[model samples]
Every structure is written in C-alpha cells, then in structure tokens.
Target: MTSAQVEKGSEHTSEEGYERGLGSRQVQMIAIGGAIGVGLFLNAGANIAKAGPSLILMYAVAGVIIFFIMRALGELLLYRPVSGSFAEYSREFLGPFFGYFTGWTYWLLWVVTGMAELTAAAIYIHYWFPDVPQWASALGFLVVLFVANLISVKLFGEIEFWFSMIKVTALIGMIVIGLGVLTFGFSAAGDTAAVSNLWAFDGFFPKGIGSSLMTLQGVMFAYLAVELVGVTAGESENPEKTLPKAINTLPWRIGLFYVGALTVILCVVKWTEFAPGVSPFVKAFAMIGIPAGAGIVNFVVLTAALSSCNSGMYSTGRMLRTLADSGEAPKAFNKLSVTKTPALAITVSVLFMGIGVVLNYIVPEKAFGYVVSVATAAGIWTWLMILISHVRYRRAVEAGRLPASSFPAPGGSKGSYVAIVFLLFVTGLIAYDSESRVCLYVMAGWAVALGIGWAVLKARNPQIAERREPEFEKV
Candidate 1:
C-alpha cells in the first residue's frame, strides 16, 4: 500500500504509520545512547594518541557543530515529525531525487555502520573469550540483537535504554574516580593522577594543532549517529517536549561524557601510554588497580557496540519503510507486522549486515577502521542534507507556506548555513587523508548510482516525481 493509505485524523500519519510507542523516558535514553557509542569506549584511544589532550578540545568544538545540526533537525521535526526523518524532509523541501537519495544513502550508512559495530563487538568479546573466533562472536551477537529488534520497537528502546544507562553509569564512575585521584593525591590511579597531565607531558597540544586538525575527520566520525534522536520524533510519544529537551541538553552530554571522561583519563595516564587499537578506558581502569580491569571494560565496550548495532537496525527499518510507503521501494517493505513494526525491512537490513561477519573473518583487526571511514564520510553527507533541507524549510515558513516551527533553530537559517560550512571543512579533512580517501571515491559512485536509480524510479512511477507536499498550518 502507498503511504497515502493512512486513515485521516489518526495519530498515524501517511509517512509514519507505525505505532507511537516510544515514551518520553525511552526517547531521552535513546538520545543519550545515540551519542555515546563504541566510538568513545573503543576508538577514542586512537583519537587521543593522534591528537593528544587536544582531542578533548576537538570533541567540544565538534559537539557544538553537532548541536547546531540537531537544532536544525529539531526545528524540522516540530514542523512535521516522521519516521523517515531527514529523507522525508529532503523530499518535501529539496526534491524527489534528494528525498530518494537521502533515504537509500542513510540506509547504506547504517548497514556499514552496523558492520563496524559488530566488528568492534567481536573484538571486545575477544577480551573475555580469547579462544572464541571473531566471526563466531560477530555472528552470535548479530543474531541476538536481531531477535531483540524484531520483537517490537518498544523492546528496541528498552534495550537501548539499559545499554545507554550502563555506558553513562560507567562514564560517571570514571569521572568520579578520576577526580578523587586528582584531588586526594591518592587512590587506585597512583600518584600520577594530577590535573597538570592536561598540559604536563608536552603541553596541551603535544602533537601540535596541525596533528589535531588532521584527526578531525575521525573525531567527527565519533559524533556520526548523534542526530538519531531527531529520527525518533515520529515514534516518540511526545516529541514536542522530548525532542527539544534532548537537543537542548546536548552541551552537558558532550561536556560530561566526552570532555569530562577524557579529562579524567588523560590526567591519570600520559597520552604516550595509550595504544592505537586499545581502549583507553581499559588502560585507565587497569592503572587505577581495578581488578579484572580489562574484563570489566570489555563488557562496557561490548554493550557500546551492541548499542550502535541496535540503533542501526531500528533506523534502517524505519528508513526502508519510509521509502516503500512513498512508492520508492518494493511494496512489500511497506507491510507492517502484528506489532505495527516494519519486520520485512528490518530483516533485509539484518541479512545485509551479515556481510560484516565474513569481513570479520577476513580481516578482523582492521575491519572496524575500514567500515568507520566510509560511515563517517556518508554521515557527513547525511548531516549536510539535513542542514540544507532545513534552510529551504525555513524559507517555506517565511513565505507563508508552513507554520513557523515551535522549536525553531536557535540562529534560524543562518545557524544552518554556518553548520554547513563546518561540515564541509570536515569533508575536506576526510579527502586530505590518504588512508581515508577511499570514502570520497565510494561516495561519488554511490551518488551516481542513486541518481540513475532515481531517474528509473521517476520513469516507472511518475506520481513519485509529482508528489505534492502535504499542507501544514500557514504562518
């Protein structure tokens, strides 16, 4: 059925026909889980090694840009919440081509992102069961999470709520422990837990500002899924209150988790002590004399990976359903199961993610790095489209086309314009790095393929190209 089949005056809109089971608590927790992922728990050691303590500054600066991006997205959500999120907005504000491309690209983005998460999950598993093959662990974890996601979106939210709670609790513990070590000059971290560690080893920018800028792409990648909170507005029981609250609290989340945790870790251990592939959390726990430190941290990182993969499943399903409902994907994907969940869409996404298991067997150690670079580059595209779409949306509002958003972006269209420039700068950094250069190449191919697919879709279904935007309140 085309999404136009949605009954009028029902809570279910044509674009978001699924049940709105995501309550306020679930929405808030999911928003938190979206930002705190395997990136900080597993990959941050590498970022710290690359940029020194300056890594904290990179995260702060990147967090501000991300907040602006979310504000733009929040404004759009208040205007018209939908499960399709950015893709739907792009279709309405930009064109059918952009809308179609955004949906597919975002789907691909998560497919690859889930693979990365699985790869990292398996590695974290190895910390406990050294004998377990990475592929076996990857497969095991995938199957478990897949089952969890299939049951219901409520289950997905509950799982994520707990997953994020664990991560947040751990970070809070670390911050407290680190602060204790710093002030008392005693505790598990040894006498080395001095505040001077921020600039002690080789000054704050030990690797120099140039080195830090070079790592901005990776730092930004850590923030890839942060916008996911906006995507849940459709399912959220109360987006007006939940979304603005989530977006508004972003600065503190960035401050406490990324900035606070990193400060504690760096102050306790010298930057040189962090290994490229190892998690700094593990190192800090071990240094502080926590028993079974690696094992404890291994569990945390595992959940972090689980958190990301779980989110990937949730989003890809909603996105595919959005496409199918719009007549842009196979009609089968539009079918909802007993729980009003998009089961078929979720199943297809899971099957595709199984490719990560094979890659894990092929090159287990390097799999995360490869998948992350591409995901990051794809993420940059996703964020850019959101800001651009919001700019056009704002113009529509001003022209008396749609109502002024209740949750308008702080700086309005100009904020979106500035965020656009920052994202472009990050894109440049991705291109400048030789190791990360393949993402640009792959993105180009993906864009061209999407362009051709859009043309064929338009030819087959002319109505898709001539879709009329649904009317909303006038300013």
Candidate 2:
C-alpha cells in the first residue's frame, strides 16, 4: 500500500492507512441499515405472535438497554478509533485471551447470522420463484453480496445506503398507510386498523409476561447489528464527528423503525392473524387488499437478508484481519484487495456462510430455527465481552491508569452493570426455552472449540506473545 493509501481514500481526508472511503452519509446510513435487518423484517412476526401486541413494549424496553450498550461503545470509540474497535478494547482492558475470544465469537456470530438471514432470504425467493430450491436462493444471494463486498468499501457503502433507504421507506410507508386506514378508513382493511386491536383480542399481555420473556432470545437477536456502527469507525471519514452523529440517532431509529413500525403492524392486523413464518409487513398490506403487498414486502425482506449478509462479510473480514494482526488467525487472512477491501478474509467468510445453503438441503425444515438460536447465543457472547471490557476500562479511568474517554458512557459503569444483568436475564430465558436450549449446547461447543484452537495457535506461534500491534491501521 502507498503512503497515500494509508492517509486517505481521497485527497480531502487525513486518516493514515485506512482508505477512509466511507463518507459521513454512508456511515450514517450504514448505522441505520445495520439496526434494521432480517430480524425485524422476518423474525418479528414470530415474536409478535408469542407476545401479542405487547411486543411493542418489549421492543421499546430492549431498545433502551441497547441504547445504553451503544453509549458505552460510543465512548470507547472516541477513546481510540480503530477498525478492530471492541476487539482492541477488549484486548487492552480485559486480557489478550478475552479479546481473542471476542473477535472469534463475533466472527462466529455473523457467520451464523448470515446463514440465518440467507435462510430467510431463501423463503423470500420462494415467494417469487416457487419451483426454485431454497439452497439455490441462498447460494445466489451469497455470491452476489460476496462479489459486491469484493469491489470496494465505497461500493459496499453505496449498496448499504440504498438498502437502508429501502427499509426506512418501507417502514414509513407502512406507518402512514396504517394510520390512514385507522383514522380515515381509506383502505380496504375495513376498520381493522384501529389501535384498539392491540388490546381487543385478550388484553396487552395476552400470553403473559412468561411468554414475552421467552421470546427475549429472538428479540435480542433483532437488536444484533446495532453495534455495527463501531465496526465502521476505522474506515469512516471524519469519525470524530460522524461517529457520534450516527450513534446518537439510534434511539430515534429504534423508536421509529422497530417500536413504531410494529405498533402500526399490530394496529393494522390483529396479533392472532400473524403467523410465525409470515412477514407482518406483508400481512398488513394484504389485509388492506393491496394487490402487490406480498411482492413488495418480499423485495424489502430480500434486501434485508442481503444487507445482513453484506454486513456480515464486512465485519468478519475486518475481525479476521484483527485476529491475524494479533497473531490469533492465519496471516493471509489479513490481505487486502487493490480496492483496500479485505478480499481474502471476506471471501473466506462468505464461503463458510454458504454452509447455510448446504444445511438447507440437509435439513430444510428446521434450519432457520436451529441456526437462529445459535446466532442469538453468539450475539449475546459478543455483547457480554464488550460490556466486560468496558467495565474494566471504566475502572482504569477512575484509577487514573488511563485518560478519561472523550465521550464517557452515560451512567458510567452503572449502565454497563445494568446492561450486563439484563443480558444475563435474556440468556437465562433462552435456557428456559425448550426449543432454544440448543443455543446453550451450541455455546458450550463453541467455547470448547475456540479454547482448543487458541491452545493450538499458542503452541504454533509463541512469537505472537512478543508481537506488537502494527502502528498503521491493522484492521
């Protein structure tokens, strides 16, 4: 790489190493697009069915906790911005082993998340091409997005920008059309859009808090990519200004996209009508007799799946590079393309994600459920590691061992403490679930596997212990 490549993607920038190819608009939209994914577009129907209309409240509550989590992460980013972000922070504060584990766990999380999303993508494709096999759909989307990420980060940002715009537009349209039907009785939904539908069936907590809590596993999964903003910090132009701007808008996005959209959905179609496999967005439009409802929602959900796979490729590539720089992964995984994209790392991750396609052939019926449960556990592990590292970071600051963060976490360590407990409660709820008990099994297996891998790497590369982080952007 040339010195200019390190300094900036364009002549107007100053970061020395990374392309800094992602403009502020791209970063802002990437944050928005990241927060809204297949979880909301696809898995949400199942959650609403479990919790009834009260799922709105559940999502709002989860949003608040997630906000706190983001705040802690935001503070960390301003402390020291790097593509490796949390993995570096975890290494610096928690321990090398914990950092190594966090990077791989995040990598694993997105691998499965991509798989789970492709599982949903297959179903969406089936909407248009009924005769095509699910595996074919999964493979097709995987290849397309893999090629996209290979081109350049700028191209990736462009793709994500439009992907996010589609999601935001879909949600806004739903809300407006839903309200019109509710107040003016304009649509063919026939008074089905009334807000009273939230309670008309069997009251707000139709299935009780137990059922709602049981769905927390998936609910938390919907919030999985909310921290992706941190991942983009390294490549982002003007991160000092753009990073905070992106992170600050999250609360509104959560309220508007998740809480508001779902509330509008339940208002349009009673909870009883929403089935586990159905997209509530499609169902809402169909209720109003919109002829292209299914097709429109299918397109949106398809983009959501692709968007997730796109992000999965992006994050895993960066993380593998981090692990490689840290001497935890194969050094070749760190190689970048001419466009400065981690082509090798991204291609490797995409190849692994295609496992989802193969699994569809082997067990088409239960693939999404099983893989999603595993992804949920992996997501929780990543978040837990982030919090643990942040706690340690807070202590170091308080003790004057490290300088105070430019953007300190709100409520300081107390917020992290509360968020940790909340995450544990959600994990406990997953264990309590008979269907989701497999997540615990998966987590145990992953831990053992990662431990074994670490041992092997340590023996193979003892020099890694003596290695220092490269002064340039190692990510």
Candidate 3:
C-alpha cells in the first residue's frame, strides 16, 4: 500500500453511535481510579513481605514507565481518538490480524480482571458479614455494576467518579494520619512509628535485589487498568483537551497513591508487620489505634474493587462492539440500546464475568490469584501493542506517510522503545517466577486459540483478511 493509502486509514474513525457523555471531571477520576485498585490496597502487603522498603522503588519505577506508556497513547489519541483505542491503532499501523488479536485479547483481559475484582469485593464484604457466602457477594456486585454500565455512559462515569473519589479521599486521609503520628507521636503506635521502620527490620532490600525484582510482575499488575483512559476516547466530550490533561496527571497519581501511601504505611508499621493477603492500610490504621479503622479501610478497599470491576464492565462492552464493527465478532454486538449503550455487548460480557462467581463458589481460596496472573499477562500484551503501534506511527510521520500527533510523545519513539524493553523484561521476570509462570502458559493457550480463530475467519471470509483502506485527514 502507498503512503497516502496508509495515511488515509490512519485518520480517526467516527464514533460508532457512542454518546460523548463522559465529562472532564469524570474522566479525571476514572484515570485516578484506574491507577489505584485492589492491587495497592490488598496485594501491596504481600509484595512488601517480598521486597520490604524496596517495593516503594518498584512502584516508582513502574509508575514512570506507565507515564511513558500513557504519553505514547496520548499521542495516538490526538491522532485518532476512538473507543477502540489500541486495537484501532494496531489495525491501522500493524495490520488486520494484529487488530483482531488485540481486540479479543483486551476483551479477555477485562473479563478475567473483572473476575479478580469481584472475588476481592467478596472477600472485603466478608469482613463486615462473615456469614454471607462469597459467591453470593460476588454475584451481587456483578449484577450491580452490570446494571450501572447498561444505563448510559453518563451513569457509568458518575458512578466511577464517586467510587474513585472514595479511594482518593481515603488514601489522602491515611497519609495525613500517618504523617501526624510520625511528627507528633500522639497515637498508640506513634511511639513506635518511625521512618526507620522501613529499613530497621532487615535493612533496605531486605529480601535481596532478585526478590525485589520478582515483585515487578505484581507491581505491574497493580498498574494494570491505568490505560482505561485511552479506551474512553470515543465517549470523551473533548478528547484533545480532556485526554491529555488526564494523562498528564498520571505521575502525580502514582507518586501519591502508590509510592507516597506505601511510604507512610511502612513508616507507621514496619515491613515485618505486613504479610501476604492482608491490607497494609488496614494494618497501619489498626496500629494507630483509630476506632473502627480496619472497618473503614475495608470499606474503602471495597470501593476500589468495585471501581475497577465497574471499569471492566464499561471497557469490555465497548471493545466487543469495536470487534463487531470490524466483522471480527457477531453483528448483534454492534447494536446500541435506546440509551445509546451497547446493551447486548455488555450483557454478553457480564455473563462471562459471572463465571467469577462460579469460581468463587468452587475455589474461593484460589480464585483471585489464578485470575490476577492471567489478567496481568493479558494486560502486558495490550500495553505492548500500544507501544509497538506508536513506534510505527512515529516512523510513518518521519517518512511523510502521515501527519504528526498534536500531543507528540516526549522523547518520541525512543520513549516507546524504552517502555517496550521494560515490558519485555517484566515478561521475562514473570517467566522466572514459578507462581506467575502459569500466566504465561495460559497466554500461550490464548495465542493458539486466537490463531485458530484467525485462520478460520480468513477461510470463511477472504475480505475479512484484507485491510480496508479508509481516507485520512490531518488532525
């Protein structure tokens, strides 16, 4: 294909009947909520046991890399903002096959991630109602989020905005309380709380660098849904203004939510006090002698879980519709409800997400860990596609094949290259860790499944195999 043909296909695709209902405030909160999840609230304790104070550094480093990834995505959104986001860019820059693979893989990522979130929410609810069954709680949460998503993009955005607000407000409160304890020594544990707690237990890097490095896989997992902002492009009221503003604030969000909050918590309660499967925030609050502290933190973490799962419901439906529009999925998926929401698409994804409730019933103990690893692995693939596509778009611009993005990524393609290498190294780390290795195995099976689907698709509809060249206009 000629450069002009490539350029033509690169222009933004029209929003396929989606209402631009998400406003700037809701979009900003969605970005914040994406960065904070059960990963930080629940999983950080386990990582601290493995990496000690060094887990803070892991989050900071991963945060920077996430910033780069968002910048790369921001550049692309300005070029062609679509609800499809990564999959659309993959189709335009890479080919039809890559696009199909990306769309389905992303759908799988959210579906499984939704399961993980539901499982987490169930566990949190148990803290309040020990008598309730885990499966019932999971099913209850799934239905609630599914209905919210089915209403309208506006309703989904509003629910997410408040869910995120609770998480952000709680973290800030925890940080402020911890700092007061350190500076004034007023709380019960204030006498023991000290900055030295970070290294006093076993010295920094207490578990060794290799142990700390292994935590990267989990750290990256905590940062999984941050890219959900890019998926909101088509429904964003002002993609050019809102998307960049949201992406630019990622550094602050990571620094405050992940690194800052962890620092204060570790200082308040030594790393040794943290253990796998417990929330460090809850532990710190209990240590500080705050009345009903653990319960409050549990409520906040519960919101975090619901927030991420809410996002899963929203994105999975849009992604399925994107696939349907491209003929990769059933045509019925592309239909819009009276509310302008993808009702059929959302319903199908919710049914798949309900499997999480089943897993909770069958293997409550193992459900979260099993689904989280697979979601992290799928997430890595999605990020890689975005970077690879960004690099190709940059090259196209250089060759005069396309126009430059208004929000050009800083360091241009080099940043994408560095982020790509970082992701590959993290993948290697996943393979190195025995526990996480299962995700790679699962991903292998997923790849084979998609490969067979692609072959069948090509055989059935030869035109589906051909890339449709659309006309492009400079942004």
Candidate 4:
C-alpha cells in the first residue's frame, strides 16, 4: 500500500482506540467540569466589583468567543482524533516546533493550574480551620488527588463526575433560591431585602465600558478549562460520535451555568454591594434568612476546588504522555499502567502541584495571583497555536492535499483567522491591564524557554533540522 493509504488507515486505528476509553456521559461532564471553576464560586464578586452589573455582559461576550473557538476545535478534532488532539494537529499541520511549543505550554498551564486549585483548596479549608496551616491543607489535598489519579481512567471519571456534581447542584440551588427571593419575596431572619438590587443601583454597565473590558480577564481564564474536553478525545470511547456530542453542549453549559448563575446573582443582589469576601449566592440566601447558605456553599466550593485539581492532574498527565509519544518529553511519561493510565506522568505532575502547599505557607498572599498569571499566559500560547494549526489544516484541504473531512470548521479557513484575531485582541488586553501584567512576563519567559528547547532538539536531530529548513518551491 502507498504511504497515503497507511496514513488513512492509521486514522481509523486511532478512532477505535479512543472509542474504548471515553463514553458519552464522561465526555459531557468533563466539558462541564472544565468550564466550572473557583472563578464562578469565589471570583464572581471580583468581577462584580470590576464591572458592576456589566459583568453579565462581559460573560455573555466571552461566552460567544469561547463557543466559536470550541466549534473550530470540534471540527479539527473530528478530522484527526488522536491522543494529543490539538497538539498532534499542531505538529502535523503546522510543524514540529509549533507542536512542541503548544504541547509543552499546555502542559505547563495545567501544572500551574493544579497549583492554583490546590492553593484555593487550602485557603477554603482555612474557613473551617482558622489555625490550620495553609501548607498543610494544600499538601493534604495534593496527596489525595494524586492517589485518585493512580487508578484507571474509568475510576477517575467517576470521581470527577461526583465531585463536579456537588458544585453543579450547589449552583443550581443558589439560582433557585435567588429567583424565589426575587419573584415571591422569601423572608430570611424575619427580614426582607428587595430583589430589585440588580437594577435598583445605577443600572447595568454602572462601572463603565472600561471596567467591563477589564473583567474579561477573569471570565477568559474561568472558561479556560472548558477545552479540557479536547484532551479527553484521545481517551474517549468514540471520538467521532462522542466528541461532537460534547462540543455541541458548550453553548448550553456556558449559558445555563455561567450566564444563568450570574444573572441570578445580579438580580437578587445589588452589583455595587457584591463583595468578593462573601459568596454572593450564600449572601443572597442569607438575606432571606436562609440558614446554612455559607456552610453549604463552603462545602460545595471545597469540592469544586478538589474537582479542578483532580482534572488538572489528569490533563497534565495526558499532555505529558502526548509529548512523550511525539518525542517532545521524556520516555517515562509515555509508560502506561495496567489501567492504561500514564502513571509516571501523573506522579510527576502531582509532585509539582504539591509545591502549592509550600507556597501557601511561605507566601499565602502572593500565591493566588502568581498561579493565575502563569496559567493565563500558557493559555494564550495554547490558543494561538491551535488557531494557527487549524489555518494550515484547512489550507491543505482546500488545496486538495488532504481528504475531505467528516467534519469541517464552519466558515472554513476564515473562521480560524477570526478566532485567532479575537484571541490576540484578548491577549493584548490582558497585557495592557496592570492586573494581568504578570501574565505577560510569565509568557515571555516561557517563550524563551521554548526557543532554547527547539534549538537543542535541532542540534541533536538532523532530520528535524532538515524539516525546519524552508523549501523555496513555489506554491
């Protein structure tokens, strides 16, 4: 058979393998789990303070961008269902350097994100134990998450499903109570606060467009995890069927969980009065004298942080395995356990995450921003690579070099460019904001590291060097 025929057949082999790993339900919840983060539970108040009632508009706009990007990703995933998904696509469609940079950067993002999640877990634990050391709590959670990941993929999925379910249930409950207070006038502690706090202040956009723009930083990062679904494509039981099913829900998940929840919060409480120190959902319920709102949300946020950390470990492991597969990372990361899980990668990633415990104790005040900025910087790089890779993929298709895809990105090459430009704008905005300036610095340092890596790899591999040599042949 010709080389082309072998390439075509390998596609089928990859799909069959993925089908054995991921199911429909796991795929759906994984997407949901990624989008729902501490940002929703803890950071909502910060957004409110920044944009006031306009925070809703910020989420809505960011949601649209996220939705389209997912669609573009969905199209790419359908055509080439591999273990690394986008990272693999970046290598084949863009180049080896692009792939290496994308995969490692994404891995770095997950590692830093794991750190943030563990740190958040520790701080939340502080609510219950005023005297307990933050480092101790962070360390304890890291150990627990590591063990959970050592099991098979199916087991990991089960744990994440339940963990995410707790948070989802809490948010739904809050929304319900909030609406009840708004419409039927529920009484709490024999006192009633009017529900018109949503608009009773200075109207939506009270913070002006400037604040609304700045709030995008949080919303963007909050939605960063949603793409975790793409990584699961390699492990999914049926990539063709399951992937599309999962991608289709991106809009609904964002709307119901993000937009819906935020709308409820604004409607029940005045945006100006929203405080980051308190859970708006809990405070709203407390306004109606509902008992245990704080405790309930506290427990839920704890679980949410745990789930995010859980996913962080799992995703970073998978990315490491992918890198190893593509000759970008160490060989050990590619080794799988009896459960077909990357055990070594999981262990190493968790070890790095344990630093969160140390940082929590050593520098509790600086830990949050440090973790977030690093994650955001890596996220920008990953998205940029994805868009660039898709652009190349579509060009090959249009030039009749590649087979007609089973699924195609809407608007074809044009859509990819649009997403790329929009993402770049967001990256620029993040850089301009003083709050996100650290992210810029972190990414700059990361790019330099990637450059050094590429240079070393080139010096060692003549074949790679040849590939990097640009051809002068005319298109």
How close is every model to the real structure, measured as TM-score?
Answer: 0.95, 0.95, 0.96, 0.91
Model 1 spans with C-alpha error above 4 angstroms: 1-15, 473-475
For residue 19, model 3's alpha carbon misses the true position, in angstroms, by 0.7
Q: Write the per-residue lDDT of candidate 2 for residues 335-402, one digit (tens) a residue.
A: 77778877888988988998999998899878899889998898888788778878987997899866
- In model 2, where do residues sit more than 4 Å from their true spots? 1-16, 463-475
What overall lDDT, based on C-alpha atoms, would model 1 receive against the true structure? 0.84
Per-model lDDT: 0.84, 0.84, 0.90, 0.75
For 114-156, candidate 4 gives per-residue lDDT tens digits of: 8887877776787779798888888888888788888778888
The reply for model 4, stretches above 4 Å from the true place, is 1-19, 189-196, 465-475
Tens digits of per-residue lDDT for model 3, 1-475: 2334323333432246778888899999999899999899988988999999999999999999999999999999887778899998988888999999999999999999999999999999988898999999999999988989998999999999999999999999999999999999988898899999888987989989999999998899899999999999878877777889999999999999999999998898888888887788888888888899889999999999999999999999999999999989999999999988899999999999999999999999999999989999999999999999999999999999887787899989998999999999999999988888999999999999999998988898888877755336422
Per-residue error for 175 in candidate 3, Å, reads: 0.6
Q: Write the per-residue lDDT of candidate 1 for residues 191-274, one digit (tens) a residue.
A: 777778889888999989988998788877788788888678667776667888988888899889998899888988888889
- Report the Cα RMSD per candidate: 2.9, 3.1, 3.2, 4.0
Sort order, TM-score high to low:
3, 1, 2, 4
Model 3 segments beyond 4 Å from truth? 1-14, 470-475
**C-alpha root-mean-square deviation, candidate 2:** 3.1
User: Worst ten-residue run, lDDT, model 4?
Assistant: 466-475
Top lDDT: which candidate number?
Answer: 3
On TM-score, the stronger of 1 and 3 is: 3
TM-score between model 2 and native: 0.95
